[model samples]
Target: MSTYVIGDIQGCRDALLRLLERCRFDPAADRLICAGDLVARGPDSLGTLRFVHGLGTAATAVLGNHDLHLLALAQGFGRARDGLDTVVAADDAETLLEWLSTRPLALHHAATDTLIVHAGVAPQWTVAQTLALAGEAQAVFADRERRRAFLPRMYGDAPARWRDDLTGDDRLRCIVNVLTRARYCSAQGDFEFAEKGSPGAQAGDLMPWFEVPERRSAGTRIVFGHWSTLGRIHWPQANVWGLDTGCVWGGALSALRLEDLHLLEVPCAG
Candidate 1:
């Protein structure tokens, strides 16, 4: 009953299948946790969604920035690119999207004591706080009425720093950004969304969210995707594991076993 945490995937269903086979995944025994961006930019977004959705109770996924983009496009808020159009036009699009919307932005796996998110947690937030904040945003995405209003207006980078006093859409957006789009941020929790390069590539005081001094979420292991440019799965001394090995960009589709940190990858080269 091993649990494997897979990376972005980004709609590469064939690569995902091969990677799962490499791990010898069994729906009857093993559990799969997807680090998000399950669709977009690959050859089979619709098929990938259906495959994961079909996994039923065996699979769990959090929403990535790309996942939210697809959600917004389905509701006339944004335009599609890559393979998302197929998902939007599918007969079962509504059902698939509904399941996606129900997914939380932050999830805690009790067996591994690992927090799984698309990106990283806010430097100032404790593990419990991260899950609580994620619940707030989850409520909005879960309610159809609020979903209609929020999806269209969800894109933004303002109020880059998080404050406990934040309210309304601003609060929801902040939580979403931290759990989904975050990469580089100041120690004070000010996100630097533009820096997607590896650690040394950034200028100024911004550092990788997990590397921030005295990060409240430290000590507990964090597994995340969304930063393929990061160049490796394990950092020298960090407790976080970066699993996005650029699967959609012609790199390997990667996965890590939670119990032993056993790693494996299957090259797809896009």
Candidate 2:
């Protein structure tokens, strides 16, 4: 049984299929771990959602920014942005929303020491702490009334630094951003959301989340997507693999074999 970790799909169903074919994936014997961004930007968002959701126990996905955006839009918290073209219209958005809400913000495979999250974690957090925090935020979204109230308060930058004293929505927002949209952070562990380009393009003071020294979870292997411009980075010391190859921007879709750390790439459909 092989387990493959795929990069951001971004709604490119054809590329996903081709990548699976290249890997000779058999659902009966293989498992897939998706880095999320399963919808938006590219064509066939609905198809991508259905295909991945159909995999059931054979596939696991961490929630990405786009996936959360879909949830927020479906729940009437926000509208779709210009570049993000969602395939789900008003009529069929409910099904997609329900499926997306069930996805976790992070996944940990204890046996393999593979920690999967859509983006990076706070520098101060250990893997166990991160998972506990994620569970707290996920609980809000899992509850019907709580989710509605939480979505509005979800968009903010306050509680910039991690504090155990931070309670209520402020704490939840910080957790959400770190697990979803975070790219770079200040040395103090505050998120810097303004920069979306490659790691070095940002100001010298800002460092990619993974670069923060003394990271508590550095011992475990982390697989993440979101910074497509970073392409693929294999860091030996950190046991980190960045798999975002920018399929929505005409780059290839990538997958990493978890058992052997082998890579497989499939060119995106124009």
Among these predicted structures, which one has the highest lDDT? 1
lDDT of 2 by residue, 143-260 (tens): 7788888887788777767888888888898899898888888888988887888767898688888888898889889999988877456877767888998888999999999888
TM-score of each: 0.98, 0.94
TM-score of 2: 0.94
> Candidate 1 at residue 203, lDDT?
84
In candidate 1, which residue pairs clash?
none
lDDT of residue 120 for candidate 2:
86
Global Cα lDDT for candidate 2: 0.84
lDDT of 1 by residue, 89-121 (tens): 999999999999999898898988999999989
Count of steric clashes across candidates, in order: 0, 0
